[model samples]
Target: MTPEEWQAVLLSLRVAFFATLVSLPFGILVAMALARWRFPGRQILNGLVHLPLILPPVVTGYLLLLTFGRRGTVGQWLAELGIIFAFNWTGAVLAAAVMAFPLLVRAIRLSLEAVDPGLEAAAGTLGASPIWVFATVTLPMILPGIIAGAVLAFAKAMGEFGATITFVANIPGQTQTLPSAIYALLQVPGGEERAMRLVVIAIAVAMSALLLSEWVSRAIARRIAS
Candidate 1:
């Protein structure tokens, strides 16, 4: 692959990594809330969490642009603090995170839901504080789910295109990720070979992540069972 292709590959990895890393804590909290907490507007929160999945990618992208663009309500305010998102690689990261968040939350939520409340109640009975109970018992049981959710979110970020492009404009070396690069190559004549190369790389990265997630989850489950 050429230098530009290499850049795209690296940028995609970087963007996806940061997007997943940054979203992990929030995803965990949101998942915990959805799975364990009974609160008003729970359904509304759930719907909003999964909204991106139901909406068109382009539409999601457009919404990001509207909300985070340079002149946008939030964007302008953020820009005052020197935190810009519109037309930047960081914007790509934000876009990818938003697009991938639902999968991350869903995976973790299911994992949390599957946990036995009895175990937690027992810990509480034994005088463990709520936070301690969660840290010791709940977190261990839900480790596999967190791993799976993170991998899913990473894979989703790797392939993110519409929101990224709309928000970041696919500038090379700055915002051109793997999917955006492939799309760009496909639009030109004689670019199929390069596009195919990227396609393979994307598939390889995604598959590797999934396999690694499976292995880690199983290993953790076995350890927990033992």
Candidate 2:
């Protein structure tokens, strides 16, 4: 791969890493809420969390632009604080995180739903606070699911293009990720080879993440079982 291609790969890895990392905590919280709690506006929250998945990527990007652009409502406020997302790599991270959030939440929520409530109640009866019970008893049992969800979120972030490009404008070496780079390359003649190479790289990276997630999750499960 060319140097530019390599840059895109590296930038993509960086963006996906941060995207998954930043979103994981929120995903877990949201998942736990959706799975374990009954509250007002629960369905609304769930729908909002999954809206990116349901809406067109372009629309999602446009909304991000309106909300986080330098002159945007939230963006203008953030810009005053010297934190900008418009046309920057950080914007790519935000875009990827938002786009991949639903998958992460879904995976973790399923796992949470599958967990036995009695285990948590037992811990509570033993004088454990809700937070303590979750941290000590519930969290460990959901380790594999968390791993799976994070990996899936990372993969989704790696492949995000439409929202990313629309929000960040595909600035090479700054915001051009693997998917955007591939898309850019396809726009011109004699670019197919490079595009194909990037495509292969994307597929390889995604597959590696999945396999690693599976291996790690199985290892933890076996250890827990034993």
Candidate 3:
């Protein structure tokens, strides 16, 4: 691979890492809410969380552009604050996060639901506050699920293309993630070799992440069962 290809690979890793890291807390919270809390508008919140999974990637990207573009309602206000996203690497992260969030939330929620409510209640009975109970009791038990969810989100971010390109425009060395780079390469004459190289790398990364997540999830399950 050439220097450009290496740059794309590195940038994709960077973007995916950040996207997963930044969204992990929110994913965990939302998973907890969906798994345990019963509140008004719960169904609506669940729908919104999973909206990206249901919507076309292009539409999601376009919506991000409209909402984060300089002239956009939220974008205009954010611009005054010196934060920008549209057409930048930051926008790629935003797009990737949005697209990956549903998967992250879903994985975490599944794990949370599988947790025994009795354990949490026991912790509470021992006088642990809700926060402490979650941190010391709930969180430890759910670590594997969190890891699995984060890996899934990271893998999703790595392959994110449609929303990323629409939001960030695939600027080389910046927003030019692996998928974007492959797409850009494919458009040119004799770009197949480079594109194929990237394709292989992307598939490898995604597969590795998935395998790792599965292994970790199973290992944790076995440990808890024992």
Candidate 4:
């Protein structure tokens, strides 16, 4: 592989890693809330969380550009903190995180919903605090789901192009993920072979993520069953 291709691969991995890591805690919290809590505007919050899944990727990216773009409201405030998202690698991470969030939340929520509340109540009766019970019991029981959600998010992040490109234009060695790299290669004359190689790489990454998720799910299930 060329140096540029290698750089794109490494950058994609870095962005996806950070995106998944940063979103995990928030995704778990939101999933738990949506699964177990009932409050005003819950439905609205759920809808908003999932809106990105339904919206056009370009539209979502544009909205992020508007809200988190340097000249935009929140973007300006963040810019003052020496954080510029637009046209940068951080923007790519943000776009990937946003695009993957819905899948992560849904996987976690399903797992959370499947957990028995009676177990929680039992723990509470045993003098276990809510936080303690969640940390020990609830979290362990739902480990498989968390892994699954993370894998799903990682896969989604790997394939994220529309939102990522729209938010952070394909800059070599920076925001150029495998998918974006493939797209760029496709646009160039006599670049089909390189594009094909990248396409294969993308497929391999996605398949590995899925296989890893399955393995994790099975391991967790076995542990839980034991």
Candidate 5:
């Protein structure tokens, strides 16, 4: 790959990595809450979490721009705190994270719902604290779901284009990720070859993520069975 292509790949990786890392904890927490708790507005919260998946990407991006744009309400406050997201790498990360969040939440929530409450009760009977029981028993049982969620998020981030470009505007070498780079290349007269290369890279990245998720899920299943 050319320097520019390599740079895009690396930037894409960096953005996806950080986005997934930052959102994983929150995703898990939300999934657990939705699966195991009963609270007011729980249904509303669930719908909101899945909104990006149903809404048009352009609409999601526009909403982000409105809420987090430079002159936007939250953006202005964040800017004063020395954090800027508009049209930057951070914005790209935010867009990716938002778009990928639903998938992560769904995967985790499914696993959480499937967990045997009896196991937790057993741990409690053994005098294990709630937190300790969760850490030692619940987490291990749900490891497959976590891995699946992460992989799904990573794949979604890799293919993210609409929301990202709408929010970040495709600035090369900074906020430009693989999908955006491919879009930009396709727009140029002689950019087909480069765009094709990036497309291949995108496919490879997505396939690898899916394969890894499947492998991890199977491993976790086997471990649990044993």
Candidate 6:
């Protein structure tokens, strides 16, 4: 791959990594809530969480632009604090996170739903706090699912283009990720070969993440079984 291609791949990895990492805690919390609790506006919250999946990518991007653009209400405040998202690499990360979040939440929520409440209750009866019960009894059992979710989100982030480009634009070495770079490459003559190379890289990276997630899950399963 050319240096620019390599740069795009690296930047993509960085954006996807941060996107997954930054959203993980919130994913877990929201998943747990939807799986274990009953509350008013729960459906509303769930709908909002999954809205990105339902909306057109361009629409999601536009909404993000309105919310996170430098002159936007939240964006203006954030910029005042030295944070910017619009037209930046961070915008790519945010776009990826928003697009990938629904998948992550669904995976974790399924795992949480499948867990036996009896186990958590048993832990609680032993004088464990709710947090302790979750940490000691629930989290370990659901770890494999969390890994799977993160891997899924990472893959999604790796391929995110529409929303990312809409929010951040295709700025080489700054916001151009693998998908955007590939798109840009395809726009000109003699660019198919480079675009194909990027496609391969994307596939390789996504497959690697899945394999790693599987390996870790199997290891955890073995340890738990032992």
> How accurate locally is residue 88 in candidate 1, as Cα lDDT from 0 to 100?
89
Pairwise TM-score winner, candidates 3 and 4: 4
lDDT values of the candidates?
0.94, 0.95, 0.92, 0.92, 0.92, 0.94
Clashing pairs in 5: none
lDDT at 120 for candidate 5? 99
Error of 6 at 145 (Å): 0.7
Residue 205 of model 4: what lDDT?
88
Models 1 onward score TM values of 0.98, 0.98, 0.95, 0.98, 0.97, 0.98
- Predict model 6's lDDT versus the native: 0.94
Q: What is the per-residue lDDT of model 2 for residues 144-182, given as tens digits with 9 covering 90 to 100?
A: 889999999999999998899999998889999999999
Tens-digit lDDT track of model 4 for 35-128: 9899999999999999999999999999999999988899999999999999999999999999999999999999898889999899999999
Cα deviation of 194, candidate 6, in Å: 0.9
Model 6 Cα lDDT, one tens digit per residue, 149-181: 999999999999889988889999999999999
- Per-residue error for 26 in candidate 4, Å, reads 0.6
Q: What are the candidates' C-alpha RMSDs?
A: 0.9, 0.8, 1.3, 0.8, 1.0, 0.8
Model 2 residue 93 CA deviation (Å) reads: 0.3
Q: How far is candidate 2 from the true structure (C-alpha RMSD, Å)?
A: 0.8
Model 2: ten consecutive residues of lowest lDDT: 137-146
Q: What's the residue-level lDDT of 87 in candidate 4?
A: 91
Runs in model 6 deviating more than 4 A are none
Least well predicted 10-residue stretch by lDDT in candidate 5:
216-225
